[model samples]
Target: MKKIFGLLLVVLAVFAIASCVSEPAPKKDSPLDATVAYPPKILEHKGTAWGANPPAWLMEALKGYKFVERMADYQGKIVVIVEQDGESREGAELAASRLDAIPRISTLMGLRVKDTFAGAQVGDKDKIETYMERVVKVASETRFSGFMMEDSWWTYLQTYTPEGKADKRTYRVIQLWTMSKAALEKQLDSILKGEAANEPKTPEKERAIQAVQNAFYEGF
Candidate 1:
């Protein structure tokens, strides 16, 4: 009887294996008349003007979602100059003076004057130069030609109140400026698509700005 039971178990196992082997796989979709839809192409444009505060032409050119810069140029094509917010003003000022003294500084660093984001107490001269070189290399690969300090240098100075809270204000002005500009640029982008009235026209010099804007925004 034990021998018969063992034989029966062996027979069931064979049947199970055979059943699994006989099962069919799912069919794959063939190339017959089936249509596949793809995502739409996004428009690319420079973000020089603040998005929310975008010049009329800029907003129009960028009909789709567009990336723009705040601390740098609006479209990442222009460079911006910045200084610390009041905490690291000293370092920023020092760097600016250094740059002015050495016009070739940008070339040495592989950066355009517009691309350098110098800050205070961020690093020593050698370190700053090295950092700028790397920054320029990377920016060149992207949409930017160069960048400059957009930080309000005056703000950095004002933070040092008469009460001697200078130490508390220890921050890299240029780095902070870069970050702040990026944030503001994003904020402005949100408002780019919405309708807003044109910026007020002003003096002759201001009128010249319109022509530049026309070129930038119109591109024709």
Candidate 2:
């Protein structure tokens, strides 16, 4: 009977120990968890230069306009340059109003004014050209109607030197543009079929035609 009581006491002690012991707390997902997937690719492009070939007449019209640095299209919409400064802003507003008044252009696609900083220092001429090309390519690929330029300055520790002084530099100016994918596809179709009857046959004409085609297909 004593042995039985001892065994019962031992079992109760084991039960008590098990009850007192706690299971490990559930692990929480970290705020910077890598398990989360990246967002889906968006149809948009951005750059420092224009991508689409504007009509010859439009090009001539834009001449002598220093504020109008670059222009391009997002789908059917005309993306115009908008200098964020007071003078440029006023001009952009006037242009926008006038564009809204135009039946032919406005009816087809509305205008989009993209703000830019004039005094930005972007490397040498070659680098600037390359940057513009990249922007235009991105704009075409992404099918974005408008983009804005943002200047960013930052200071970082110069660890290369023994003193490790704080160094400041203009990190970069980022341009981001986005447009509706559906709108871009629709405009591309219209552009491809608009003048099919009088399609250019000359090499220059063919190249021009190819440029628009590539904007839709190759996105550059």
Q: All predictions: root-mean-square deviation over Cα? A: 28.5, 26.2
TM-score of each: 0.19, 0.22
lDDT of each: 0.29, 0.29
Q: Put down candidate 1 lDDT per residue, 16-91, tens digits, no spaces.
A: 3321212123244559934422211111111212222223322222231122232124453322322222234465
Model 1: what TM-score? 0.19
The residue-level lDDT of candidate 1 at 63 comes to 30
Alpha-carbon runs more than 4 Å astray in model 1: 1-67, 70-73, 80-91, 96-168, 175-220
Worst 10 residues of 2 by lDDT: 152-161
Q: What is the lDDT for 108 in model 1?
A: 27
Task: Note the clash tally of each candidate.
Answer: 26, 9
